[model samples]
Target: MTSSTQAVELQSFLSQITDRDKGLTAACAAIAEIGAAAAEMAELIALGRLYGSIGAATDHKNTDGDVQKQLDLIADEKFIAALRRAPVAVVVSEELNEPLVLNEGAPIVVAIDPLDGSSNIDANVSIGTIFSILPVLPGAGEPTAHFLQPGRVQLAAGFAVYGPQTSLVLAIAGKTQIFTFDRRVGAFIRTSADVQIKEDATEYAINASNYRHWDPSVKIFIDDCVKGADGPFGRNYNMRWIASLVAEAYRILLRGGLFLYPGDHREGYADGRLRLCYEANPMALVAENAGGAATDGHRRILDILPASIHVRSPLIFGSVWLVDLVSRFYADPHFSPERAPLFAQRGLMRG
Candidate 1:
C-alpha cells in the first residue's frame, strides 16, 4: 500500500477507538471503573452506621466472632457482590470460609478483608477493606488458580478506610495515590499526590510480649532498636501496638512508623497472625509503592504467594529505611538475640 493510504487507514482505526471504549486495553483508564465499584461498596457500608454494633451476630462456625461487632453481614454481602461484578476471576474474603470464584476466565483475582479493625468499631475508630489483585492464568479454571499466583504479580491493590470521611487508596503497579469521598459533590476526588515514607522513624508497633517465640532475626532487630547506643540501631525507638492493621497502616502513612507481627509459638499461631492474602499482600503493595517496605521479617511480603486463601504469615512492614535497618540486623551476626535456643546454647545473661 502507498504511504498515504496507510496513513488514512491508521486515522480511521484510531477514530474507531474512542476514550469511552478503550478502557480494557489500558490499565489506567480501567481504574475509574474500579473506583466506582469501591465507592458503591463504601456507600452501602456507610448505611446503618453504628457505634459498637458491627460484629453483633454469632458467626456460623460455632465460635465467638473475632470481634464484638462483626454482625454487619449486609455490608459485607454488598461489598462482595460489588467485587463479583467486576472483571475479577476469584475473590477470597475474610468473611468467607473458602475462596469465591467470580468467573472462570477473567484475568483478575482479588483477595479482600471485607472489614478490618472491627474490634475497635464500637469506639468509632478507623476500619476498612484491604484488597490485593492478581491476574489469572489463561486456562487454569477455578481450582487452585489463585493460590499459585505470586504476590509480586499483583496488578493493583488498595483499601477503602471508612473513617470520619471514607478514603480510598490505590497502588497500581508502583504508583500510590489516595481518593477521598467528597460528601458534598458525592464523588471520590483524588486528593493526595505521591506518598513518601520518611527515611527513619521513632515509632514501631508490635506485640512484644511474644518476644521469646519470635525468630532470632526479628528479636535481634527489635532488641537492637530499643537498646539505643548499646545496640546495633544506636537510636532509642518508641513502640506502639494497635491490633488493627488498617489503623496501623493509616498511622504509618500519616506519620512514619514500622509494624511487625512475626511468627510466634502460641497455640494455633505457628505462622504469625495476619491473613496473607488480604492483609499482607495489599498492605505490602501500599507500603512499597508509597516509598516504604513490607516483609515477613525475612523477605518482601509481596514476593511470596499463598498456598491457600486463609493462609497466615508473619508481617513486618513500614518505612523503607526502618525495614532496611531491620533487614540489616537480620543480616549481621554481632547483635544480641532475644532468644538463642535454636542456635547458641545460652544467652549472654545466662550463668
Candidate 2:
C-alpha cells in the first residue's frame, strides 16, 4: 500500500523466510568458520601462483584426465577441519569416497564440493566451493531437515564463488540472497540482485559434441540456443561451456544465463558429471529461490531423491521460463521427448 508500509512488509517477508527456519543461526556461524578456512585455500592458490607448483603428476584423478592439484586436497582437509567444529553430525565430500562422521553428537549433516572448478586454478580461472545443509534423520527437528538429509531433502543450500572477489549465494527454502566478501572486514556483505532469477534469458551453455547422445528435450533446446537470434525464440542466445561448475553457475547468477551439463555417452558419465548433494542441490536451492530453476533436464533438482550423499546427476539450471519450457518439452508429445536417443528420434518424435 504505502511506501513505508511496503518497506516494513518487505522486511517482514524477508525476515520470516530467512529467520523462521531453525538451523539458520547455526548455519550463519558455520559459514563464518567456512569463510575463515577458505582463506587457507586462497593462500594456497596464491602460493601456487608464485612457485607454479601444483599437485604432482601422481595425484591424478580416479575419474578422468582432469588435473587434481595438491591444493585441492589441502582445501578439502582445511574445510573439513573447520566444519568439524560446527554442530554437524556427518559430512560428505566429493574429495573423499565416503561420508565422514565428524561429530557423533551433532544434529545437521553436510555435503560439500570443497573446491569446485579446481581445474581452473592452474589456468588462473575462477573457482569456488559448494555446500548443501539439511536435516540428518529421525531425532532431527523441524529446521533440522538439513544436515544428514539427502539432496532431495535439502532444507538449505548455497555456494561460495572465488573469483576476482569472493562471493556467496545462498538459498534458505523460499528466498535466495547473494553476499560479497569484504577484504577489510573479512566478512561477507549482502550485495547484488536480491537473489531473484530472471524469468527468461538470452543465453545458454552446453557441451555440443554430445549432441547425438542427448535425449530429445536436450537436443531441442541446444538447437534453439545455437539457432540464436532465429527460430521461435526470437532473441539471440550466446553459448558457453567452461566445464567448471562454479564458474558456469557464477556467470548465470551475476547476469542471467542457462547452463546444462546433462547426461551423455561419455564414459563414467552415465548419470552426469556433477554430484547431486554438493553441486545440484545448492544450485537448485539458489536458482529456485532466486526465482529461477534447476533440474536434471527432467524433474526439479530439489525433488530428485538421492540414494547416497555422493550421488551424481545431470544438471540443467537457470531462468525459470527456460526451465518451465524444458519441463513442457519433456511432458509434450511433440517436443522430441523420450527416454533415450533411439525412442526420442525414431519413435517418440516421428509425427
Candidate 3:
C-alpha cells in the first residue's frame, strides 16, 4: 500500500523505472504529454457553466457522426497540440476524419478519444480522455497502419477521469496503476501501484433500455441477472449505467463488476458504439493488466486486429469470472439459464 507521504509523482516514477527499452520509453513520454493535457481539461471542466456552454452541441459532427460538443473540440485540440510536442509519430483521434502525422520518424503512435462521454458535460457527470500507445510498425507506409495492429502490441494504454478528484488509470510494464492529480503539486501522484479486480462481484453495468434490441445471448445473460436471488445465478445483483465509459471503468477497477456494450439490432449500432482502437483497446489493456479480462463476446479483445482506426466494437470487460461467463453465453447457446435445464437446476453462480 502506498502512503500519502510515500506517494511518488508520475514523472519521478517514470524516471525511476530501469527498463530503458526504446518503445516503452517513448510510450511513457507520450503518457506524460497526455497527463499534462488531462490536467488542463480537468481544470476547464471544473469551471462547469462558468466555462460557457461547454455542453452545448455544435454544428459540427465527429468522425463517427455523433454531434460534437463544445468541450469535445477543445479537448481534441488540446491533446493534438500536446502530442505534437511528444515523440508520437502518428495520432488518430475520434474528432478527426483521418490520422494526423506528427513526426514521421518517431517510434510510437497514439490513438485517443480526446473527450469521452461529452454528452454528460451539462449533467455534471464524469468525463474522460482515453489513449492507446503503440510502437510504429517497422515497414508501415501509412500513418493509419500504425494503428491497425492488435491491442496486444500496445506499449501502454490508459484513461484520465475528470471527476471530483481527477484520476488516471494506466496499464504499463505488466501492471495496472492508479494516479490522482494533485493540484497543490500540479502533478499526478501514484495512489495504487498495482490494482487488481476482484474475481467476484455482484454489480453489472449496461444500458437496460436497449434490452429489446439486444441479441438473444445478451438478453439471456441479462435476464438471469435481472432475476436476482430467485434466478438461476441465485444471487442479488446491482445494475449501473452512468453513460460514461471512464466513470464505469474507474468504478470497476476500484471494486469489481462487468460492463457490456454489445452489438444490437439497431441501425448504426450493430457493431456497438465504442471505438476499438482508442476506447476499447485501452480499457481492455487496463482491465487485463489488473488481472481482469475483456472480450468482444466470443473473442479476446487484445487478439482482434482493427480494420480501421475508427471502427466500432462490442466491448465486455471486468472480473475474470464474469467476463468469461459472458463468453460462455456467446459460445454455447444452451449454456443460458432458460436453455440449459442442468445449469438452471444446478445454479451456475460461483464464488
Q: Across residues 266-335, which tens digit of lDDT does each residue of candidate 3 receive? A: 9999989999999999999999999999999988999999999899999999998889888888886458
122: Cα error in model 3, Å: 0.5
Model 1, C-alpha of 282: deviation from truth (Å): 1.3
Please list the residue runs of candidate 3 whose C-alpha ends up more than 4 Å from where it truly belongs after superposition. Answer: 1-6, 18-22, 336-351
Pairs that collide in candidate 3 are none
For candidate 2, which ten residues in a row score worst on lDDT? 1-10
Alpha-carbon runs more than 4 Å astray in model 2? 1-22, 55-67, 139-152, 336-351
What is the TM-score of each predicted model, taking all chains together?
0.78, 0.82, 0.94
Q: Which number leads on TM-score?
A: 3
Which should have the higher lDDT, number 2 or number 3?
A: 3
Residue-level lDDT tens digits of model 1 in 225-340: 67864654445677887667877887787778898887777786777888888789889988888888998867889878687777888888888766765666667645434333
lDDT of each: 0.67, 0.68, 0.90
Output the lDDT of residue 299, model 3. 88
